[model samples]
Target: MRGLFIIGRTTAQSIPTMLGIIVISFILLHLMPGDAVDAIVGMSGSASKETVAQLRETYGLDQSLPMQFWNYLSGVFQLNLGTSISYSAPVLDVILERLPATLTLMLCAFVLALAGGIVIGWAMAVFAGRWPDRLLTAGSLLLYSAPNFWVGLMIIVLFSAKLQWFPSSGDESIGAGLTGWAWFLDRAHHLVLPSCALAAFFVAIYARLTRAAMLEVLRQDYIRTARAKGLHPMLIQFRHGLRNALIPVTTVAGLHLGNLLGGAVVVETVFNWPGLGRLTMNALAARDTQVLLGILLLSSVAVILTNLLIDWLVTWLDPRIRS
Candidate 1:
């Protein structure tokens, strides 16, 4: 609201927030039933105590908890997210490799959800108390209450298993030598089911929120005044009402946008898309602490950035925010 200074202040707060997440993730992660060395040994069936001790020392597991945390913090400052015990790669590299797929999926889902919600919400508000409003409310409520994983599964069953319209799993079809626009189209083809699955719940939420906001705005003195002045209904609704309604919508968008990333874990798992969600799953299974911490940190950063972006946008849209 205060412009660059406010945004900068908020951005600075991210350091401590990220540090807290890192600390918590490091501590709780170590408390898990088995260590990375144990996971490695389990894979090979057996190992000598000497070999185990070496692995422990190698990973700095032998150090005191405070020391280990200090070292990890130092590495974090240097952009070293430590190493993945299972992947035998830097944590950042592993996450970055899979990041694009997750980003693409979330971005697509968010745009679709935001656009659909705005349109359906405005329509519902315009036809408030009528059959069209009732129908939209009923449908949106159903979607909002439904579990996304179940929705994703059903979508797959209907669209892929039955209709053969989309592949049920994976980011892309294997061995298809498509290039350029065709290549993008191929990726988009694989993206539809998962993105829709992720977006469905968000669309419902946005629609309900938008409808409520607009209806409230429509009841305000200014809106009534505009109507009394002989303004065109469409122009008043769109330019006057909708614009004011959007401030609250922007708040909701900022708060929940990061949720799309979290939701991607489930949808990605359901659809087998290579993204941070699936990577988180695999890291958890393997007790890959570095990768797990990296992902959690990245997720926290994303949420913070989203909130900052929304703050700027809301200020631009409503001067009251600048106060």
Candidate 2:
């Protein structure tokens, strides 16, 4: 009951924040110079004033801004995101179709990052003040500070172009159907370079955070008590120190997951992955208001949901948070 109440309150608070994001995004997008119809008509200077007006009316661009915003708000409640001016498809349909590929990539990257971080962090923490710890810390910092696009380019050069170990770009081959193990393997193969690029930054941050948190936890009196009682080193670290150390790491990981999805624009474009990021870029270039708005709303909702899930996980991991 208490947990449920907390969750309810959290969700209630999130509503206004989400609304603010939508409002701000809508206003900024509109304020940007140039209209969708103008972009569609192009610079050939052939479109007449009558033709432009007709196009604007057709796309509801002729309506007052407030009225347009109101209609959009109502449409959102009905899950009708309007048709893309550019794609000619329902915005929601286009977004949903691409969502699975993005999610799969993110999930694989998250798992790899988490596992790698824990192992490296644990080792560094256990061997504190040693040369190995210093080396690991230095390597982590170097990777953490590196720009993601730079890392991605390096991966592409090494693995895709030079080594020819994986496909250079795209989610999968043109003819690969979405069924059977062969299809799965092909998709995974294509996913490797992109996922690694995405995971590398997270892995470094997670490892450093975990190492620091574990080191702090290990210094506590309780940890000393566990050690004094003759518990094995592995058991002492895993059974005692790890759970406590994870509170901070979990927070970082949750925030990173939100960032990964929202900021995948560059990485997705680099890999030519047909995800929300790529779609958003194309929409922006074409001034497709419907598609842009849909992507913004979807990304905002994803971040909010991820935060909510993190709250629940934190409450579960540290019971005092429930109160």
Candidate 3:
């Protein structure tokens, strides 16, 4: 019941937040020097002044900014995000087509980073000041310092180009008639590189966060009491130290979802992955305002909902936060 109330309140608060993002994104996109018509005309290589004027009118880009905003807001209320000039489809429909791939990529990356970080961090904490800790810390720093795109390119060059280990580009094999587990395996194979590229930076961040939190929690009075009570070191560390240490790690993970989404743009572009990130880059190049706006709104909602989920997880993990 309390969880439901928290979810409701959080969602209510996020309504204005999403609206603000939508308005700001719309205004900023319009302020840029190009529109969907410009992208279309550019793509065609030439257009007469009259043709350009007609295109603008067709796209309703001829309206005043205020009118445009009003119309867009009204449409938003009705769940009409407008049509994509590039894709020639309803904006929502276009986004939906790409959303599943993006979700899959993000889910894989999130799970890898969170799970890998926690384990690495726990190992580092348990072996503080030892060789394992030093080695892992240095690796974490390297991963954190490296840009995700560069890492992605390197992975492709080494794994795909040199070793012939993984496909360099795409989320799946085109035209493959594989089914059931075979299809799932094929998709997973394509996913490995992109997921690693997207997750590398975040894994480092979570690992460092977890290590610090674990160290702090391990020094607490209860931890000392557990040790004095002759509790097994592994049992105390996992059940007590790690559990308390997770609160801040969970908070940071929630906030980083936005960054993760942003990073996916570069990773997807690098991998030619058919995800929202790749679609976003294409939309930007074409100055497709409708598509851009739709993606932004959806991305914002995703981040918001993810943070809400994180809040629930944190609340469940730490009963004190419930107060």
Candidate 4:
């Protein structure tokens, strides 16, 4: 019941948050210095003034700002995201088409970061203040502060150019005759460089956060009692300390979910991946308002939904928070 209440409350809050996002996006895009109509007309190779006026009318650009926003909000409620001016396709369709690739890359990177971070963090906590911890702390700091794009380029140079291991850019290799598992393997091969580059900074951050969390949990009375009870060190660490430490880490991960999505835009551009991030980049370059707005709205919604899921998981992990 408490969990349901939390969810209900979050859902209610999200409604206003979403509205704000829509209004802000609409106003900013519409109020921007550059004219979307001009952008469209310019792209069409010197369109006549009549054609320009007709295009503006077709896009409802001739409407008053208040009226246009009202129509947009109404369409939003009806699942109408408008049409992409550049692609000549539905904005929602363009985003949906590219979503899977983004999800795949993000998920793969997330899993890698999570696993690597936890393992390294656990090891550091186990050997706190020792040479291993010191060495790893320095390394993590370096990685966490490095530019993701620069890291990606280095990865490509080493793996793609020097050793000739993975594909430099793309989610999958083109023109391959492989199928089934083989095709999947090729895709995974291509995914290696980008995923590693994207995951590196996150791994560094999670590692540090997990290490701090574990240290704090280890100092608790329960952990001391577990140690005094002659429990195996591994058991006490894994079953007791790490489990409790993960609570805060989950919150941190949820907080960073939006950042990860935003980072995907740059990462996807660097890798030339055909995901929503890359699509967003192209849309921005072309000043395609429909596609850009659609991508931003959907991305924001995804982040909200993910945070809600994290809240549920956190509640499940620590029922005391439900109070």
TM per prediction? 0.96, 0.95, 0.97, 0.96
Q: List clashing residue pairs in candidate 2.
A: none
Q: Compared with the true structure, what per-residue lDDT tens digits does model 4 show for residues 16-43?
A: 9999998899888876666667877667
Q: Residue by residue across 215-286, what tens digits does model 1's lDDT show?
A: 999999999999999999999999999998888888898888668888998999999999999999998888
Worst 10 residues of 2 by lDDT: 257-266
lDDT values of the candidates?
0.90, 0.87, 0.93, 0.86
Predicted candidate 3 versus true structure: per-residue lDDT over 283-318, tens digit per residue: 999998999999899889988989988988998899
**For model 3, the run of ten residues with the poorest summed lDDT:** 34-43
Candidate 2 Cα errors over 4 Å, as ranges: 43-45, 176-179
Candidate with top TM-score is 3
The CA-based lDDT of model 1 is what?
0.90
**Which has the greatest lDDT?**
3
Clashing pairs in 4: none
Better of 3 and 4 by lDDT: 3
Off by over 4 Å in 3: none
Ranking of predictions according to TM-score: 3, 1, 4, 2
Best-first order by lDDT: 3, 1, 2, 4
